[model samples]
Target: MAKYELNTKEQHFATTRLEAEAIVTEAKEDKHLIMHKIAEKHNKYGEYFLVDLTFSYNTPKEIMGVE
Candidate 1:
């Protein structure tokens, strides 16, 4: 099983890639939101996130058996 998520000041979890992407698109378009640094992290469980270190926004797309 895998999961996806979008994070800003808050963490938003999604069940599919499409949903996650939608969240990202929305966040990018939100003028009230500040997006500075973003990073991708791969964990042992194959879960990864596009993260902003300060507020720590994590967009995670998990694929089974993938690093």
Candidate 2:
């Protein structure tokens, strides 16, 4: 069986490629969020394989004002 792993600040795993892709697509829809697919690898653990997908993004910062 092959598993797909999506990495950002945290890790997410999906059993199918479509599921993995869906996660990325949803993330992209956020207008304030910037995301990139940094790396991808296959056959991570021999028989227990994985398609590892790594992503990089900017974390949103909030500004505060004091009167």
What tens-digit string does per-residue lDDT give for candidate 2 at 9-52?
Answer: 43456556666677677766755344434233457553221333
Error of 2 at 49 (Å): 9.2
Q: Find the number of clashing residue pairs for candidate 1.
A: 0
Best by TM-score: 2
Clashing pairs in 2: none
User: Which stretches of model 1 miss by more than 4 angstroms?
Assistant: 1-8, 36-67
Model 2: ten consecutive residues of lowest lDDT: 58-67
Clashes of each: 0, 0
Residue 66, candidate 1: Cα error in Å is 50
- Candidate 1 C-alpha lDDT tens digits along 1-67: 5454444364565544565566677666655455533444556766444533223334343333245
Candidate 1 has what TM-score?
0.37
* TM-score of each predicted structure versus truth: 0.37, 0.40
